[model samples]
Target: MKAAEPPVPGLRQPGERPAPGPADGVSVPGVATPSSTGSTPSPAGAGIRGKRNAGALLPYLLIAPAFVAIAAVFVWPLIKTVIMSFQDVGRRELWTGDPAPWVGFEQFTNILGDGEFWDVVWRTLLFMVACVVATMGIGLFLAQAMQRMTNWVRLALTGALVAAWSLPLLVATSIFRWFADSDYGVVNMVLTKYLGLDFRGHNWWLDPKQGFLMIGAVVVWGAIPFVAITLYAALTQVPKELEEAAALDGAGAAGVFRYVTWPVIKPVFQMVATLSVIWDFNVFGQVFLMRGNKPEPEYNLLGLYSYEKAFESNSFSQGAAISLITVLLLSGVAVYYLRQLLKIGEVE
Candidate 1:
């Protein structure tokens, strides 16, 4: 090629530089354009600078009042009770606004060694067990029957149960006391007139054994509603397909329940029994309303015992000790049942 004939006038050879100031219509690098005006900040970059914590801790801060309320009402009293259980105070010290005496474990020892305390313990245990068993048994039967009924019948039964549950404990106690009253109660009338039995009803509240039985009966009546509702909910959850499958296999109603329903509901039964035990152990209203101030021959339970020790006998330390024992018993029951409830669903 002609040794590179000079490039054309306005065009340069390949890779050659443009002319001095400008190429075609474009300006040279030395030239400058006007800077942009009225431009906004980048949305993403602006967001980073304007970001705040969004008050992440505001929810917990709002709930602080509730936590304080619970601690002030429940936790503080529980702590005070525990502390008082260990101290000793004479009647004068307890009543005359004097300081409590520090007796350490003496109150605990006294409670353990006391005959009446032990008797109350025995009675409490017996009553709790009996009430729990009777409540659960009747509750289960009623729950099963109600679960199989029409919606109308089920609603009626539920309404009745709710009525029983909603009845004030005092009201129930009054009604039952009137019914069992030896003088003019309807219960004795029915037994004497309708049944025509030789057994003339005596003063149920006057005897401790009879009082315990009456209290248990009243408690069972009130408690069955709760236990029955709990079991009914559990029964409703039993797999309908499994029940149908059992029926298809020529299994009778009892057989199907025994094999399929019982297994599924067994855990619920344990839960109800444990809860009822705790409730029965803490029963004070029924016994207190029926039998007051009397000891072995009339009323015996930890609650009544504590009340008598503190108010009747002026043994504040002993009362606190008994109350603490009751607390421990209830706590143990709660822990046991919590563990059971945790393991309940794992079986299936």
Candidate 2:
């Protein structure tokens, strides 16, 4: 309603201010001006921000292929195994083009109802616990000893440990089998001739309970080197000054280890223990090769039991169910350890 304002020089419109020029030393609210070099100033931090964003995505891109491969190789098979467990997958359906009929949880129920299965489960648990305890105990002792040994002695011990660790599972099993031979084994000979215990011609693998102990011994022997080396490596990271200080404070060897060294290496020990539990619990090659073509029911671990059910007995569904149970058990241990590690991280 008011009279129109007079046109203003350098104004785009009547209400607008004069457009800023190079000599004016004024800036537009949302526009960038050229610098003294005559090049336009870039949007604030645009190049740096772009580089930061690319860097953030680089790690994910690098790992994507590995993730894809794992998903295809391991995850896919696991999913199929789980699906097969819920279906009736026997020789007919496996060979024929027939669809496997779903019998949800029937195989699991059958396994649960079988007394023999329960017995095997108990034995497997006992075997796993025994091997874990024995392996950890012997490994800890050897690790501590190695830390104090002279260089030459340490070198020899390390070589022996590496040899044991490097032995393949099947090869180690064969070696132990030879050692347990009733007629010619060195073990029986040592007991009979050297120790005067009359263990000659004792068929160690005949009795199921005794066979479990024998095979467990083999597994423990093979497992010890890894655990020992890992613990020793962790021990080396603990500062010698701390141990000396503890010793200076009137702590004996045991007290120094318990107070000063244990805390630093406990995490490594726990990690090794968890791995031992997993490996021991799933051990199949040793027991299978030890029994040699005809594995006894008594010596059947969860791993061997599952194998026998699927391949030998042709009970694929039941075998898959057993494998799932084993997976669940191992997953529980893994989850517990993961939570513990997270707690330690938070505390740190």
lDDT of 2 by residue, 270-325 (tens): 87898888899998888888888578777788998999999999999889999999
- The TM-score of candidate 1 is 0.80
Residue 90 displacement (Å), model 1: 3.8
lDDT string, candidate 1, 1-348, tens digits: 557566577767788875655335455566632332234668987776666433666788899999999999999988877777888776777579788878799889988888877887888898888888899889999999997799999999999999999999888988887888888877778888899864465677666677778778889999999999999999998999999999999999999999999998888888888889889899988877755424453476889888888878887778888998998878888998998878985765
How does residue 178 of candidate 1 score in lDDT? 86
Clashes of each: 0, 0
- In model 2, what is the error at residue 180, expressed in angstroms? 0.7
**Per-residue lDDT for 342 in model 2?**
80
Candidate 2 residues lying further than 4 Å off, grouped into runs, are 1-56, 340-348
Name the best candidate (by lDDT): 2
